[model samples]
Structure formats: C-alpha cells, structure tokens
Target chain A: MDYRARFLVDPLKKLSLADIDPDDTGDIDKEKAAELTATYLQRMEEDQFLLYADGRQSLLVVLQALDAAGKDGVIRHVFSAMNPQGTRVHGFKQPTPLESAHDFLWRAHAHVPAAGEVVIFNRSHYEDVLVVRVHDLVPREVWSQRYEKINAFEHLLAENGTRILKFFLHISPEEQLERFKKRLDDPRRHWKISESDYSERKFWPQYIEAYEEALVKTSTLTAPWYVIPANHKWFRNLAISQIISETLDEMGLELPPTRVNIDEIKAHYHAAVKATENKKSD
Target chain B: MDYRARFLVDPLKKLSLADIDPDDTGDIDKEKAAELTATYLQRMEEDQFLLYADGRQSLLVVLQALDAAGKDGVIRHVFSAMNPQGTRVHGFKQPTPLESAHDFLWRAHAHVPAAGEVVIFNRSHYEDVLVVRVHDLVPREVWSQRYEKINAFEHLLAENGTRILKFFLHISPEEQLERFKKRLDDPRRHWKISESDYSERKFWPQYIEAYEEALVKTSTLTAPWYVIPANHKWFRNLAISQIISETLDEMGLELPPTRVNIDEIKAHYHAAVKATENKKSD
Candidate 1:
C-alpha cells in the first residue's frame, strides 16, 4: 500500500497526524524554503507589534492536535520571535484539584487574552467537549451541549474585541505511532511522552470523528477553525504565520511616534566621558 | 550630585524603566565574568527543571523597580535561559477598561504560576496601590487599605504552594535621569521615552517613601521582598539567579524515568521503517 493511502486519515478514520505523508513533497530547495519561512516569521512579528499598539484588539490562538503533531515546535519556532512584552502563552493540562472545583471554563477563561495582547492556548477550553465527549468522561447529554456553549463563548469573546483562531493540526494514525516510538527511544524526549498519551492513542478513531464534527459545527466567521495540514512541519509553521500576519495586517497600526531630546543626551554623554578622561589624567 | 542619587525615585514618582543599568559587567575579567554569569544561569535552569519534576510547587517572581532598572533586560537575558515548558511571563501595564472595572487583583490572579510552573510578573498587583496612590487616582481610603489587602492576597498565594519572590531593583536617581536622556537621544529608543515618564520623574522622592512603606509592611517570610543592588547589571542578575536557584533546589525532583516496552517498540519501529523503505524503493 502507498504511504499516503495507508497513513492518510479521513472522516472514516478521522483526521490524525500519524496518517499523513511526512515526506509528502519529496524535497524543496533549502535556500528558498528558508527564505520563505523567514519572511513569514518576520511578517508575523511586524503584525504582532501592530496588534499590540492598537490596545483595542485582543487575539486568541487555539492550537489543537494529536500527540507529536508539531504543536510545541510551531509555538517555539514561529511565535517565539514575538516580543514577550506583547505576547503570552498558556498551556492547558489536566484540571488541578483547585481548578476541578470550579466549572471547566472558569480556569481557562481567566487566561483569556486582554486587549492589545496575543494569547496562545496550547490546548484550551474545548477539552470539556473533545476529551470529555471522546472518552465518555461526561454523559452524552452534557458533552453534546458543549458545542453550542463553545460557539456562544467564542461569540462573546468576539463581540468584546477578541479575534479567535483555531487550528486543528491534521495527522494520520500511522504517523502518530512512529512519532510515539521515537519519543520512547530518545532519552531527551522521554519526559514529554507520558503514559496517558499512549492510553489516549487507543481512541484515535473516536477523536478524529469528534474533531471533524466540532470543526464544522463550531467554526464561525468570528472564530474560525483553520484545518492545517500537519504532515509537513515547515508548511504548518508557514501557514500559521500567514494566517496571523493576515489578521494583523487587517488591523491598521503604525509604529509609535518618536521623541527626540538630543541636546540633553549629548551633554550627559560628554560629561561622563570627560569625567573618565579627567580621572585618567589624575 | 551623582547620577544614582539624582535618579533615585521619591514617594510621588511613577516607576519607569528609563534609569535601569543594561551593562553585563564590563570591568570584570571577561572570562571570569562570563563563567560566573553562565554558571548562575545554568544553576537556575537546573533548579527549574527539578521544581518542574516535583509537579506541585510553583513560583511567582514580582519585579518592582524604578525606570531603567533593567526589568526587561533581566527578563530577556536571565529568564531566557530557562526551559520554556516550565516558565511563563506576564508584563503588567496600565489597567484596561475591563481590568479597571474588576477588583485590583482580578488581572493578577489570572496569571498565577500553575503547579510546576514559574510565572514572572514584570509589574504586579502592587500597581493599583503604588501608581494610583502616587498619582491620587484613587481616594485615600480605597488605596490606603490596599497595603493590608496586598499582603493578604500574596499570603493566599503562598499558602497555595507558590513561593513568592518580590524584587525591588535599587538604582540611584541620577543614574535614572542619565538613562532617560539617552533614550531621548537614540531614535530607536525614542518611542519608549514618554512625557508621562518625565512628569513622574519630578516626584521621585514621593515614590521612594511609598516603596519603603510597602517593603516594611508586606515583606512576609513566605513571600519576602529582596532589595537588590541594581546599579550593577551583572550583580543584579547574579543575585536574582542565586535566590531563584536556592528556592528550586529546596524542592526535590528527579529526571522523569523513561519507560518503554522494548519488544513493542522494536516491532513497531521495524514495521514502520520497512513500510517507508519499501515505498521509497518502489
């Protein structure tokens, strides 16, 4: 069987990173790829600054993917270039004892991006619906209604100047198994490959179906889900950068005005230098 | 008067970064200084990983300093070396309309370090009492009681497995004015130097008194405030690093053990690689 055919996940298999062709395009020219990647990252950074200056607008980037689907890598390489002053990242994990006491959305809502800030959620509030629905952790009645609840929640955020971007990183089951194996072999990566991740892998087909339905039903113009092809890391990064840059480009922002008090600066500089010179003469 | 004394903030002045020292110790022997700085950073990273492995204890670092007190530089260079997976940073600025509508602690509570995470607050909840009080933005009754309220808020965080480290970067007032003048002269930095900063500088003495009062009242054992010498950049980083490393070292943590089903892994790897190889061969 062909690699793409064997690994590719559709609605039947659901979409998984493990099924896609990792080397789908053979190879591209390294220099051209690097230039393209650099340009994309640079544009993202420039637009981020504009969004920051606008102060009236807030951005929430939700990244959801199967294990080893390159979510961490994308955040590190692409968003790392942004000024820390303007950007914040929140990684959602299992609920803590304290967090469990509150509604699932309470803890997540606290981390929402404020005006003029870019907030990235590594997982996010959708877990209440996705994981809960897939594992049967919550009743069908409870988890099913979360779709409408999520849409409403996002709508509210949109009404209040928060632009939401959701990315479902698509990979195949076969691709995921390989990545999982690599994590086991590599000691440096062992910490990241948890036992729970393996247990979760058993429900791959279920997750895919849940994700597809969620994407179609919940994706709105205000908070749209961009189904990104995660088989290629370079392409995934570029796509994210392009989306972010396009969003910020739409928000008109210019560099803050410059202030000049040159005369005062030169006086201080010369005074300090002369003081040092006098000390040397002494 | 010396630069440091002239720039030392009074009780009335608003805190800005105009006077912070940025040099990484030029006078010290180059190799020795580098080794010391590198050692400090390395130790901090090691301790951070250990604390993360513990998975229960968290840390909150509150940075309070006058203008040009190396807050941003310290964040960039010092914390930059730590593992991103275990650290998060929040830079607090002026309160937004939403933030202002809520309690003073509302915004800060949202960014508390999660279990196994080290969260840095560039500015913090103290702003409501300090800046607002200094500028008379809030009434005497409302802002004055905040000292006790601030202490109570931090006390709660400490009780909940958070080790709070509050730093007051101490630089002389003269040094501040010199740095402010430099910002005005340099076009790249001109945007950062604002008229409000100049206006606040006029009340430097007033701000000092407010800080002294805060330090005396709020410095609890669970959440102590460290007043570091900020005139020397190298010294400040070294001091902060030492404090952070010591805190993490107290928390015992082992590198997470790698577990793999050797036979299962071997079988999976052979099958996957062979499948890929056959396709390539074809």
Candidate 2:
C-alpha cells in the first residue's frame, strides 16, 4: 500500500493535528499490519546493501515527536534493521554550552549523511523552531527566522546527493497521558521518566501549535514531512518502513560497473593458474 | 566451541602464518558451524541492544584481509545483523592527497566508535605496517616505529571505553586463486574485480610476513587478534561471529538503571489523570 500519500505533510499544505485521528490505521487490515511491517523491514535490509554498493546518493531521515509519541520505538523497530555499515542515527538532546553558542544548524550540518550513507536525526534542527518557540528559549524574532533557515538548509542538502525524509509522530494529549501512566506504572521504565515529563505535559497545546507552524513552513518537495498516527505502534512501524523502502526504490540504486576490463583479468587468471600448476609438476 | 583460544594470537608470543593451515575448519562439524553461527548472530542482536542501553562501552572491530579473502562476506553475514543505529563500519582504501599529508592514523582516529557504538574498520591503520612496508611506501624507520605507535594508539582507545578486536582472514593462495576465478567467471561480480587483483597476488608472501609481524606486535590483552581460517566461508563466519558474541558476553552489557523515582512519577500521573477525567465529566 502507498502510505506516503496518507501520511505525507505536503508542501505548502496547512497541517491540523486535530484533523487526523491518533488511532488511524488507514484502510490496511490491522491483522496484516505486523506482517507488512516485517516485509518492509526485510526490504530495507536489501535496499541498504544496494545503497552502500552504489556509493553515490545518501539519505537523511529526520524524526520529530512529542514525549511518548514513539520516536524511539520507531527507531528501535524500523531504522535498526538497516545494515549498520551505512546507517547512522544521531539524537539531538538539550544543546550543550558548546552547541548553544553556534547557529542552530551548525551541529546538525556536521552529521548529515555522507554519500551512500543514511543518517537519522532524532529530534533534529526543527527543535530550534518547535521547542525553542514553545519554550521561548530564544527571542521571538530569533526563533521565527529559523523556519526559512531550516528550509534553506534542507534545500542545500537536497541539491547534494541527500534524499531527506522528515516524520512527525502525531499522537493526542490523551494518548500521551496514557503512555505516561504506563511508564509510571512500570519500574523498569523509570529511567525514561524525568522531571520534565509532567511539566512538558502542560505545554501540550503550545507544542502542537509550534509543530503546526513548523510543519506548514518547512515541509518541502525536497524534504517532505509526514505526520504519522502513532497511537497504534504497529501501524506507525508499517507506515515508516514502507515509506523508507519506497524512497530507497526511488533512489535508483545499483552496483557500480566494473572498473577494469573483465577479459583481461580472465586471461591473467588463466596464466597464473597455469604457472602454479607447472611449478607444482616440477 | 570456544574458538577464541584456537585463533587468538597470544600477546608477545612469536607468530607464523605458515604454521596455521588456512583450510583448517578446526574440530566443529561443518554443518553445525552454519547452525552455530546463526545462533551467535541472533545473540549479537540482543547483546547489541544491551550495549546501546548501557551507554558506557564501545567495540571497535578491525578487519584486515587480503583481497578475495571474504571481508565483505563476513560483514554482510555477521555484522549487518546488528541494529544500524549503534553499529558503524569504515573502510580504509588508498589514501587521498589529503589523507597522505597527515599521519597515517589521522584518518582512522576520525572514525573510531563513540560511547555505546560498535565500529568496524574494513581496512585500518594496520595498513601502515602491512601495505606501507610491503610497497616501501615509507622508509624502514618510518614503518618500523608504527607497530608501537599503533599499540599506543589502540591502548589509548582501550583506556577510554573502546574494546578492540582484530581479525586476520587467513586464506591460502589456492583459495584466493579460486575466488578470483569465480569472480572472473561471474558477470554480476565483475564490478568487484580490480586491476590490482592480479598485480597484488605477487605480494602474497610479503603480505603474510607483514601480517605475521603486525599480528604479533599489536595483539594485546586489550586489543586481540583472531586468525580466522577463511578458506571455508561458513567456518570463517562461524568463528568471527562466535568470537564477537563471546566478547560481548565478557563486556557485562546491561540496560542502564532507572534514573528517576517511580513513586513520584506515579503521583503526578494520578493527579494528571484525575484532572482530565474531571474535565470530561464537566
């Protein structure tokens, strides 16, 4: 199924998180969701080798989500399936003093996927516009300018061999609270809990507004943003794996052609084998 | 089944590649080698997650193999099974002008695994000792000093959370010739052939000597070398995967402990849930 159209936040299209159901699984049968996801994951494995072998184009996957919205889950289940030789995942946390000192995209630019590589940004440069705007971490004028800057930065990457994909995991406030309660109820998940969970819960509306504007402004043909309905984890995985597999298909990846003359090498091989045989007979 | 002792180049012990038969499959039944390899590969997946969650240690695997000795084969069969998010592979080829200007290890240092990462060096700094010496790319004094330089550099990495494992894919000349013949015969694999394929074969003895010395000098308690009998590809995969699995076992990998108090989060969760429920009733 072509889930790209279902989830894609099309360029210049207005985004309303409220309009999409958090539990939406589209028309796909729920029972087949897991099976479809496995098929896609397997496809990604083969596609990754092709990408590595071609050694020309690159991929940059940007994942943005609110707390408990399944960013980590998607990565653990989907992105992890890629051969590590060619895939890289970088999570952008609170800017260190060093990062805070630079322009927002400075650190991110350092980690963009090289040729034949796929780099994943977990909570990427979009944070400058989303979280910065939500929390007023920067002056209004300073943060507002970032939307255009992000578009320009992504455009620059696109001009290079990078095919950029951004996904915003969309879940409701109710769904988030349910997830938090489960985390609170489980002792093993305590490490994931932090002082900010409840405090951030208060900023739910603010985050949604920030996300809406960022999505509307930055989603482009070159670097499309998809709003994934992630209250259903199985559906989320299937949709993401499918989209990435599709992108790899679109990349036109093929192994590079022979760099040397095959006939010449074959002659050399025959001569070498004959000499070894003659020496053995002696 | 403990293949570590069978292949390990014991520290400070004199080394000789001729003594170890490259065709040797050791005592394991051939059919069982493939089955056992799958088990270890599956174990590595779980171990990889634990290592990532622990977020404390890293593993750097250096693969130095002669051409046609199955470096790519082992990587595809073994390392690719791990999650791409935490694992990385770097292949060192002939130095570009920029790389040539710097010290030999300069380019390699840039790609070492970070905390909780597993990095594979397809060809590595050992090239300084092997190729540089064999080709007289550098003077004797320059190449002679590198064994200890390599040791000191690896020791530094080991001191700072990196566990190093080096594998020398041991294959006989006959095996290499057979591999070359297969490549010559297959059009699909022609892309893998290079002009140096035949030119490099003449250096087989020199490379063996280079490898023997480098293996003896650098294999340490911290950074060990394993001589994998790679004439049989299945046995090679089995041995390399088994050694890596055992190393992970020794690392005592575990999920990090919860960072916050569960009771405090639970109280917040209840209050939040009550607020939502009361609003719904209103």
Highest DockQ against the true fold, candidate: 2
lDDT by residue for model 2 (B1-282), tens:
688999999877788899999988888888998889889999998888788878899999999999989988887789877876788888898999999999998999999998889999999999999999999999999999998999999999999999999999999888899999988888767777789889999999999999998898899999999999999999999999999999998998877888776777778888998989998999
Q: What DockQ values do the models have?
A: 0.19, 0.63
Docking class of 2: medium
lDDT of each: 0.72, 0.89
Q: What is the lDDT of residue B79 in candidate 2?
A: 86
Candidate 2: where is the Cα deviation over 4 Å? A279-282
True contacts kept of each: 0.19, 0.72
Real A-B contacts recovered, model 2:
0.72
lDDT of 2 by residue, A12-98 (tens): 667888998989998887789988888899999888888877888899999999999998888878977877667788889899999
* Model 1 misplaced stretches (Cα beyond 4 Å): A1-22, A25-43, A94-110, A137-156, A186-195, A218-221, A231-235, A255-282, B1-47, B80-86, B90-111, B125-161, B182-195, B209-251, B256-282
